[model samples]
Target: MAPTAALLLLLSLASVCFPAAAEETLVFVTVLFRHGDRSPVRAYPTDPYQESSWPQGFGQLSQEGMRQHFELGQFLRSRYGNLLNGSYDRHEISVRSTDYDRTLMSAEANLAGLYPPSGGQVFNPSLKWQPIPVHTVPQSEERLLLFPRNDCPRYTQLVNETEHTEEVLNITAEYWDFIEFVNNKTGLKNTGVDSMWGVYDTLFCESRHNMTPPDWVTPDVQQKLRVLKDFSFQIMFGIYKRVEKSRLQGGMLLGEIVKNLSKMAAPDPQQRLKLKMLSAHDTTIAALQSSLNVYSGKQPPYASCHIFELHRDDNGSASVSMFFRNDSGAAPYPVQLPGCPLRCPLEDFVRLTQPSVSQDRDKECQLPSEGRDKEILLILALSAGALLLLIALLLAVVCWRREPMAARGYQHVLNQEGGGDDS
Candidate 1:
């Protein structure tokens, strides 16, 4: 009822409703989408889910994929209506994808949704929409884009660092047992299958597109593969800590990122890139997220998006908020930087994502067969095989032990009844 109290209350309400217009802040959105419906990426020679089985041949985005992307574009349109123009502005956004057809097409479908050509937006009247460019690099040339790349300097260096420390290697007899068991069952040479997130990401992408696995892949095999995926995620997170130490720990990348961000925030900011959308496999998302020091222990599902919104307070202090959009959860997951509240300081944000620029990504993200050293990684391979076997045995033991005594008793009773009847 007091005038002073009423005035303070009004001011607080005003700030809540019209907080410093965050409009000046450049919204950087990076979206990672699995390719839409498609045939299997690669079928084993004996695979039943070959190209012929699908309406589209192997690795082509399906109509469902198109709709998913289109809807996503609509979502973007709704979210950033003001930030976007009445028409598509090439300068406002840059799109990139892996060179695979499905990926390229997925990008197109996404663009169709994100930047549907309207009246003048169209190239031809007959067509409802026009082509918006989706950029890509040759798969062979894109080392940083590949998975399980054997030549990641950061990864190699980390291994060396950890290996140098006697305690971290932690090789044990149990490990050898695992290696031997795996070598016996798979018939493949001793190989360390540590980097499986990428393979799983690619496979998951294919499955989402309706690609089927070969009959040779039993349910157990699928489950093991999923475990490998989880392990790969763990490895990814471990590798990131190493990377942070090398690239971002000193606040070097963080500094650069902050500088670029400042430029982007400038009155004459780099209008060259309004929105940057990166369409990559789930591993790519995992890798970046891990580096950002936030690993949720799960791979992002199809069309998962991470958005960084920048804002400036009334006094012109920079801040950022990170949002993750995944399929399963009803709401976006918000992550804030350490020293900041719900929103983080921009300097920290830059520092976190800086590892991407620090490493020679071209060499690190490459496929293993090409970039990997040929020095017969036998010892490690054998050890890995042994470790896998140990894991299998441990899992088996756990399952067997969990069976209740009642279950065994019932089985014994059935066996006795069968034997008596036979006699």
Candidate 2:
């Protein structure tokens, strides 16, 4: 009896420590990462370095950018090797990037590190790389990943309104002198909190490349710019009516991701696709995180990745876990939805995030009065114009009918008689 009791005690301890991990299976993963570092998208008017200074011109990815993505790819391989096959399988994975040179090239460089051509796959002995397709659409048509779309007039109005909020007013008041100083140094006329990101980005790019900034850019000034730059993202995605803003901007992507997760949750005997990789901009990451209400209020660094792992437990219940890999040297940190646990149940996650998602983006993007009021005004204007036209025609007929018989007699009667006798 003592030996049997001891065995039961051992089994209980094992169960407590293991926590049914063996029953859970990792079924699908979605990875969204910012493109690697690049040159300044554009330079300020008074900047010493212009587009001509960079080898590949402005906004192009640099050598360091390629290296950063390559290392990131290697890290992903080490982390996900058990889930992915040793060699690349196109059917099991999909890679997409924004239709830009930097993102496309970053995906390519990352693929090189993730799947170094081996054995029969090696086309050339000298070169260690192989071709892999990265899909993209034209920038104008990209709605899923791009944020703060200008096509949405309501979103534009939201931004304009956000600029006038008390918080924004306070920020403006506090930074007024700093804004003036930056405008003076950068020779920019409009340098407010909303537009200061451009200046910060220019300086950050220059600093990353070891370029010497102007004497005015001390460390303190740089730090201030960085803070404002981060705040700019907040202003665009959060600050006011965040859920509505997300419904227009980031929620589209989130909705698609949730659909993918749902599809994977269904029983499929032929489920070949396991991973989806998206290569996009920092704004994409920020917008999606904001929609999830998991934004850290800091900039997503170059090559930073957000991961979603879906696991199915023994009873066929699926749960999702989120992790953000911001630093290359450190492990990814877990992210919990505002009220959900780190590993949130699939239904709970969908329910919590549904408010952020939009059923019809175009319909939701219309302003409160845009759909009914503007359309009604147009219909009324058209109806009024038509009524006025009809009234004018009737008045002309009345005037002609009211003319005296003598005035209408001679020429009119002669013409009518010449034409026909019925009148």
Candidate 3:
């Protein structure tokens, strides 16, 4: 009896101590990253490099850009090797890029580092690279892969409101003298807040390549310009009602990401795609970060990446985790969404981001009917009056041309009498 009692006690202890271990499985990942470094998009009209100085002309990627993406690919492989297969698998991953040479090439280079050929996958003996397709759409048709889409009138209206904000005004006033100096130095016509980014970009790219900037660009002046440029970027996506701005711009991408995550969380036996990669510009990264409220107020550096990871546990519950890999040498840092845990539950993630996701972007971008009511009414009134006048003119013309039936009969009789006289 004592032995039996001891056995029962041991069984109870085991049941209490060894409750089923919670199983955590990585389900899906979405990565959005800026293209690697490249030549200036365009130089000022008075600048030295112009269009001819660059090897591949304006906006082409440099060799350093290739290296940067390759290293980034290696980092991804190390971080996700367990989740992703060792070799390139088309069914498991999809990559999309903007229709730009730099971005397209960056995707190709990153793939090289992420998946080097092994065993039967090697097509060429000497080269370690294998072709992995990178897809893109024309710039005009691209909406998903880009941000701050110009077609959104609501976003444009928001931008106008942002410009009129007191903060923007103060920044403009603070830099009035600097703007004048830049205008005078560059001989650029009508230089102001709108055109300052061009000057800063030209100078920045030149400085990065060891080219001497103009003497007028003193350290203090450069710092001020940097501040203004940063401010400009902030206002472009942040400042004054950022959430609404996101609904029309960056939130489109986020919405797609959230939808993909939710779909992955569903139980499916044939779910093969493990990763989706987007190769885009610095603005793309900044816009997404702004939507997430994680932007650091500075432009995203070259090859910066934001990662979205979905994890599912054994209990049939799923959660989302986000990480930012802005620095090449360091590990990706975790970022928490506002009003949610760092590893937020999937349902909570969807709910928190739903407000920013627009159901119909075109509808949201349309101008309000109230604002155009008066103009439309005036146009309609003018059209109706013109139509009435046209009808009156037609009636008058028909009346003037009409001949009386009696006059027609009398003419016929006169003709008959004339014929009898002739006979």
Arranged by TM-score, best first: 2, 3, 1
Write down the worst ten-residue block by lDDT for model 1: 245-254
lDDT (Cα, tens digit) per residue for candidate 1, span 159-240:
4454334432343232445434444444435444453333444455556656665454466655655765665455544443
Judging by TM-score, tell me the better candidate of 2 and 3: 2
Model 3 Cα lDDT, one tens digit per residue, 68-134: 9999998889989988999988889999999999999999999999999999999998999999999
Candidate lDDT (C-alpha), each: 0.59, 0.90, 0.87
On the 0 to 100 scale, the lDDT of residue 27 in model 1 is 50
TM value for model 3: 0.85
Cα RMSDs of all predictions? 25.4, 6.7, 7.6
Displacement of residue 135 (Cα, Å) in model 1 is 2.3
Report the number of the highest-lDDT candidate. 2
**What does candidate 1 score on TM?**
0.64
Residue 247 error, candidate 1, Å: 4.0
